[model samples]
Target: MATNRATKSGFAAEAQRKVNAKYSEELAQECLEWIRTITNEDINCGGDMDNFYEVLKDGTLLCRLVNCIQSGSVKKINNTTMAFKCMENINAFLETAKVLGVPAQETFQTVDLWERQNLNSVVICIQSLGRKAGNFGKPSIGPKEAEKNERHFSEDKLKAGQSIIGLQMGSNKGANQSGINFGNTRHM
Candidate 1:
């Protein structure tokens, strides 16, 4: 019946909406803004912003590159020979990593754009790479210095308040007790 078909179609539409809503609005906006700027200035992609926004939000690097190539950007390469070469290089890198005992996931494959049509992967890879690279360069601190910097929450653990009686004040012994002791506190 016509009513049955309509109900089924409506349900399908609602399901699609729910699936799409899983992606955050902030992420979608970031992708959209990046795509808008890149397509407008960097690549002369002829299509409307909506299409590019949607594709970029899905995060398919190959699709983005293809879009750029179609836009006739000098910076974007679109040859099958080049793609094959890149794939070979990627395979070599993976093999080298494996030999080196590097635990990397071999996720990327030769992208056959013609066969696989959907570009639904989110394109947040660049941000993650930046974070990893940022962490890789910093030198770690020693445990003692780290302990000195550790914060204590208990009132008893609080450092003793500033004391007038000390070695600086010509006292032989250092202040023995440690607590919230307010001793003859004078405002400078």
Candidate 2:
């Protein structure tokens, strides 16, 4: 009986390995790049917002990345459909930026200082999205209280991490909440 159980277990393991092997490192990198592109297009920190061409170009690239992700060519690393939907919204925002003609390299500088500033903005947005997703398993639906908490958490996180977004008294109060308070958010 033990031998039979071992054989069954081995078979199941092999099947799981096969499934895992289908998702390659290249695919994972593509997903990450797509996410980064979307974030860069959506968020910005103080810098050079002067180049119309670069902004438009970056917005276009951002839109393309979103299109690929939503087309299902790039499978999300996380096994959550809501993530897929978030990607869709991300794509929409990129398109909006493109239409608005936001400059791509607005933060470029002769030195790494400005580049780091821009990169930090991108990182902050991604981290905020990650925290929200982590706290509320479903990006689309969380308890009203949970969503509120996430917003407060995201605000505090951005302020703490980004020098540009310094913590204000309003945000401090929001961050200091002891429990979740669902005033008006809805679950998806």
Candidate 3:
């Protein structure tokens, strides 16, 4: 049973790694470039999953990235080989990312990076961070977020909408059960 569980775990990890690999090279490169732009630090990764994970596994780069967007957000980055300290850095970065408009759903857990469980999630988090970079006067990564469209309506139009049947409620206007027959009533 334990062996089966281990096999399943291995399969799941391999699958996640492959899915992470599917992100466009252009996107990964763009994200790396954006990170350099914001942090003003040169990263040595080749934008591949392995390189990306290695460069960021310590959470130093991530802390720096978030700090670039919001200064003093992490307060202090523990630059040490200790595992717990590294986890702290990641946690700080995640929290700061949340404050910087990177949604909680977009953030990755420490284990996701530490154990290489889902580096794709880390990449996605960085992409989201890049999108929000523009708000903080930094160059954005990936595509720009869409702008909202505001519509104005007169009071008459607003009141009229309330009386109309909603699409979800559906309309029976052209839909009729008229002359309906289940095969032939005599055949029953």
Residue-level lDDT of model 3, residues 87-169, one tens digit each, is 88888888888889989898888888776667677788889988888888888877798789999999999999999887898
Tens-digit lDDT string for candidate 2 (3-70): 22333348766764554344333323333443444444553322232221123222333344434333
- Candidate 1 local Cα displacement, residue 135, angstroms: 6.8
Q: What lDDT does each candidate get? A: 0.35, 0.35, 0.79
Which regions in candidate 1 have their CA more than 4 angstroms from the true location? 1-11, 32-76, 79-188
TM-score of each: 0.27, 0.20, 0.78
Question: Which ten-residue region of model 1 has the weakest summed lDDT?
Answer: 112-121
Ranking by lDDT: 3, 2, 1
| lDDT of the structure predicted as candidate 2 | 0.35
- TM-score of decoy 3: 0.78
Q: After superposition, how far is residue 95 of candidate 3 from its true place, in Å?
A: 0.5
RMSD (Å) per prediction:
17.3, 24.2, 4.9
Q: Which candidate leads the pack in lDDT?
A: 3
